[model samples]
Target: MDLKSYFNQLTTKERELQFGRKAADPLRHAFDVKRVVHAGMNGEMVPPPLAQKTWQDLMHQKVQGHPTQMAYFHIPFCKTKCLYCGFFQNGTDQAAEDAYIKRLIREIEMDAALPRLSGAPIQAVFIGGGTPTSLSPENAGRLLSTIQNCLPLANDYELTLEGRIHDLVPEKMDVWFKNGVNRMSLGVQSFNTEVRRAVGRLDDREEVLRRLQTLSSYNQCSVVIDLMYGLPLQTQEVWQDDVKTLVDSGIDGADLYQLDVFEQSDLHVYIQKGKLPPAATTQEQSAMFSFGKNYLEAQGYKRLSYCHWARNNRERSLYNTQARCGTHLFPFGCGAGGHVDGLSTMLERRLPAYQAAIDQGRKPLMFLMRQSPYAPLAEVIMGQMNQSRLDLQKLIRMEPRLKGLEFLGSLWEEYGLWQDNGYLYQLTEAGQFWQVNMTQTLLESVEHLLGGSSQIHQKKVAAQG
Candidate 1:
């Protein structure tokens, strides 16, 4: 169907959501608000009654082809919980970690024996969680050895260990380097000592810089830090210094993140009680995003993704890049989630339950979901949008039905979101700020055009800032 024919089938409300309002500055005030922080399409939540047979028929005994693949190992224990965190599972205890690692290794061995993952070559391995860096040297060694031994790691695999600054000592760093951890992603939300303490970060500014420099002195791994823009005490000037610090720190790459405040959390309570300052409003965050993007580009740092930047070749960030574009990931450890063999699975979260499943010699499956029928196309769109450009020709080649989406390109251009540079639609500064909103609208438009679901109409609400 053509764009006009498709629009003719929808009501005004539906059109407004599917295509955004025609605003002068479509950057900050286009959408009512940003709905989801990490934006992407999802598949079926529950298996349809008839899908069981279809799943069985389509399921393969082995990985289908040489698709890029990765593995995610979750460490669910933290030495201390951050004030703003919602993912904290358990406090650190040596006895608890020892037991968990033993079971985790067992679970790894069991999955390695499965037909789907047995011989597949995983190109990237990410050990992430409450703090993978906080693991004792002994435990870290054992876990790393098991992963290197059991998994079919490719010759040039990138193994990233995520953690905090307090754990960046020589003791942990030595074991990490010895065991093939070539990438270290540390969270340094802000370098201001006052700001760090307000958010429950233990290290002071001096220690953070000293530890980062020490880690880089090893010269054996690529180091990256994460900086958040909308923290409770992170002012505009502070945000500038944080990014400045990232560039000056000589790290390989950085992630410029916007904070999401969850209601009913410790952070929220403290703010309500006047104990902490208010977080940056969404409008302010949009400006912060623009400044970060421009400053990094001016400094000659390459844009690896919408939120990620790289200063050199050492930091390709393979796992995150491939995972976003729909690479298969083998999941392990408590609370880990990954997708493989046409299904996504989340392992059990509770320690006792995870241990029991591992002991039973079965896959510790907490939830399993079949992907959406349009998953392949959705992956391409999301992956491209994240890099601030979309190829319309590729989209048309992927699915002729997507030809109707160019109506959106024409509309967004008028609103100052993107430009048509030959065959590619490149997003401008405004488009990058509102990329999530534009991405979702395009995905929803595609789904509606293809008759995937019924649309709900809303009375068009005028948005102005």
Candidate 2:
């Protein structure tokens, strides 16, 4: 049960089995992780369970004093689809938007009325969507209004609205500001026209610059721009330019993403057609990652996570740290997911199915669900891993159930993962590398518990059957 040996045995087999079965079914790869996680939920074997204590704290308006924190909202509209987008979103008529909002309000009300929630102050309210700003500014205002009415918000609460460059016109910006939206995540994938066209995101760099300038003039919010590397036409030089733009623009934060070729995306078709460049080799991608990391660090931006960077640590997203745990939030509309401390729940992604559920006086709250006792433990580990930092003592205190993970303590001692200051636990640089593998370690542990393949001996088990 050595963690490293266990991972080697399990993952090596899983990969071999996956490659063997890739053409046979193409869909069952990683099905163990997928299926077991699902089956655990449906069978009610998932544990630690939902954070009732956290909710109770909220209901009593004591969340500010609690260590759990969360914020969530859903914008169910999109102007256009990106080739690689997997989240729920679709272009819809104004009527559909109106109907979605009505149901959304109901969902929010239900969450507010949940028995465990009485007066918990929300730490953050993140409104995300196909493109949240795609909704009419009026609708956006209305949605924020609903949230304010339903939840006790912290005075320094952070409200984030996901946006597209084209959507951030003066009028929209005005409405967003008035509605207490204090942060914006502009989805500007790339400024290069050719690359933008390749990915189906129509972002005008000059116009986007103008919008950012306008945003900078606002007093109430911080701005974060999203960037992606490894596009079809993107070269290392081009991506570097994009990174430079973020540094030069005075943006508060940046989320840098790597291109992932999903099986169902149009990019897959492009890959098949030989229209896209060969996928960035892992080595090349690592170089790009290092360049961005080093460059951003030199520019005085704090490296918040593997892919997230912030300026002076001022515009940090609450979700960036594991400072909070097991706080749940409700998402309304199509394809929105609701995650509580011990549970991972999502609504149906199909618009019609979700809408029909709404029309029937129900919120589409259960398309898929998983409640695990280990969720809080996983969150604590993963959250620290995200900051590329970990605190061992705080982690142990957060989940007393994990006190039995004594071997982990031994491993920490053996590996010197953290430096103990008698008061604080901080991850060493070597520990950061291990943090990147924590999820894999956790998953491999589950596989070992299930008595499955080890030593890179892969297996393919279909969930559908």
Candidate 3:
């Protein structure tokens, strides 16, 4: 039978019976497949020159408005590339890293001097990368020192240093803690050595555990480990074991993500060549996800957001939360992405281009403002859903444009995507599984209602130029 015929054979109730709560492909119904939206803080990039007017306008508005609370610094260097990675990064080179740090510090100093950012107290600073911890201790310290001296920080500011297990020695972490870095996001991926090796992650499981234990002893800092599901050779048993080990290891928080095989990644190449075992099927992955959710909640971990769980309240992911909530972010360094005053921006991806821009005294921004009139509503909706809850009335009230979109709540309710308890709305487990797809559906519907999606204003600017 053809694919459509096969799907048509099953009724909605029958499909529910077969797949249980979550569909095999949660975004897919019998007749249609929903497209997931990449409506994060950043979107499609327009050349920096094309965005100059908009950039200046937004900067003026930003200075006149409330100060942005978060900033992100990208360190795009890695010791070795992982098989499933698709981020901009380069292999370790000491000289190149030193050069990058010097340029980054200069960029920070320049940004700090902007009248637009004057007196804007930064509440959170996220140092993310191919691996920020890959930098030498001296460079890392210099970077931290530069942030401290150049930027205005809130008294309770959060500084998160994202790292890998192999690079996280006590000495380096000590320097970070002393420099007011209070959070660590360690990329553990999986605790199974075979699975790790299959993905080109070479850290020993025992050593990772040891490092976690040692880091946990730093009462001044919180350690959050990232775990992945649906990886090659990852079984339900292995995933369960990984979760149990993480909880028992006494880490502050954990984030669970499904493995995505990008076309440019080495993992995709291995899959194409049949050199690695197949990844878990969609059904199997859904099962693993459900199991993880239940297991972690059972272990007294509070589900802070959809994928994040914390042992206690101290592990708030300010960067992730703020970014998702459409908060203004100042992006620094090569390939960093952020949103400021409604205009999405990304820095130059190539290291040389980025350094040259800094040398010539530029912000290194690639502008790509969200064009859709409903973009702000879309952002707010997705952000709330990411936390697994939504206040329908408040959402509508927040944006006048969203008032007419309230009818979407009824449609979603009919589809069992969310439950309305008179005052508030929350996604069901199945809804949570398909939240991204649902958010996209709503945003698209809004776009369709508003004549059509707005075209990139930069194209007009380019034409005029």
Candidate 4:
């Protein structure tokens, strides 16, 4: 049977039954796969546990002067629900939004009031969500005002806001620009109309280009456009044009996403019906990603991660590079995560639960992820995976827990996975092809160890539900 038929034959119950169980073995296998691939290329491997410990120590290190500099915010409101989106964003609710924003402001107040956050100048702040720009211009204004009032503002800091092409209209852009938002990331998933329809996004190419041009006119912020490949019917030809359109737009950066289908999304519904284009196989998606990387790099964009590329001279892009050293802060809404001086924390998620607690004057902290060695371990994994390159000595100096350099060296020799310049270690073609395995190894390793078998099953259920 074809992939669609194969997917269809598995009942939700059967799939759910196999969910986390299936991941455990494959995820474990991926590590060895990673080793073999790396070994083949003279890449490296370090035991994850050792890396985790080293990472945690890095996070808790309190040098006399430097402190936490990371912050994150979540705006859970969206103008419309896209079929392919899996983030925790909901359609707009004016009253609920008003309430949530007030709670968010309260949460920020609590964070600012914390002694740990007070003295440290924030190095980076990322405002993300369902669609932050979905807020009415008035609320957007208030939201900006709220952040300014609550945080210790850093003049040279990187401040990013998420927006859509339609939402980047003059009035909304004006509000965002006036408020010191130095960076804007537009959610322009695809320029192909049919592809947009296939994924339930609706920005026309002309409108997308025009809006980006308008954003370019703004002197206050750099612009980053988000593009997606691997939609139901997307071909490499189509995706290359999408990249060309983005390159032609003169934006500062681009985030190239491959379509990911969670069983809960409407995209899954189409998948079930075979009405949508078949999901691109991993091999196909990798090729598309390779195409994008080659095209963007040739156009003068620096690759920041597997999916993010930026012009060499952009400020926010520079901050991303600096953040690789673990100085970035992420203090935002529930579901948003980031690192600061190695510490990790999250605000809260359920709006009502979060708001109700904040209403009673409680800081809306769902949980503070204790600084553990795993924090930096995870960061290295994410950062390296995103950039697809590792500066071995630099990473070791940054966290010092990577005791497996020799092991990595062993794997590199055995598997032919990667090659080294004097300073940087980058993946070979085989290593590049196994990008998903690399990401899965890091993420799934954490998930399994932290939450174990039940948690995986629960996520599977959540995806299905």
Task: List TM-score per model, in order.
Answer: 0.92, 0.78, 0.87, 0.76
Over 1-465, each residue of candidate 4 has an lDDT whose tens digit, in order, gives: 222233245676543232211222231221222111111001122243454344334434444576546577888888777777877456789998888777777667755665556666776677888888888888888878877777777777788888788887788888888887888888888898888767767677777788788788876787887887777777888888998888887778888875665666788788788787676654466677778877877887777755668774573554455454455664556466555553454556677767776778654545444454455555566567556666667655664544334344334424444567666767654455455444444333443344331221122212221
- Each candidate's lDDT (Cα)? 0.82, 0.61, 0.73, 0.62
Which lDDT value does model 3 have at 458?
11
Candidate 3's residue-wise lDDT over 1-465, tens digit each?
A: 322233346577543322223334442331122123243222455565667656655555436556556899999998888887777478889999999999999988877876655557888999998899888889999999989888888888889999898877877887888787899999999999999988878677888898788788878788998999888888899999999998889888999886655555677778778998777754566677788888988889998777888998889887777777777788889999877765677788899989998898877765566544456777777788888777878766775555555665765666667789888778876677666555555555445445444211111100000
Candidate that would win on TM-score? 1
Least accurate 10 contiguous residues by lDDT in model 4 = 34-43
Clashing pairs in 3: none
lDDT of 2: 0.61
- For model 2 the TM-score comes to 0.78
Models ranked on TM-score:
1, 3, 2, 4
Residue lDDT tens for model 1, 379-428? 88889998899998898898988888888888888878899998899998
User: What is the C-alpha lDDT profile of model 2 across 15-72, one tens digit per residue?
Assistant: 4332111222222221222111111111132232333333333344433345444566
Q: Which prediction has more favorable TM-score, 2 or 3?
A: 3
Off by over 4 Å in 4: 1-64, 318-330, 338-345, 377-385, 391-405, 408-416, 422-424, 439-465
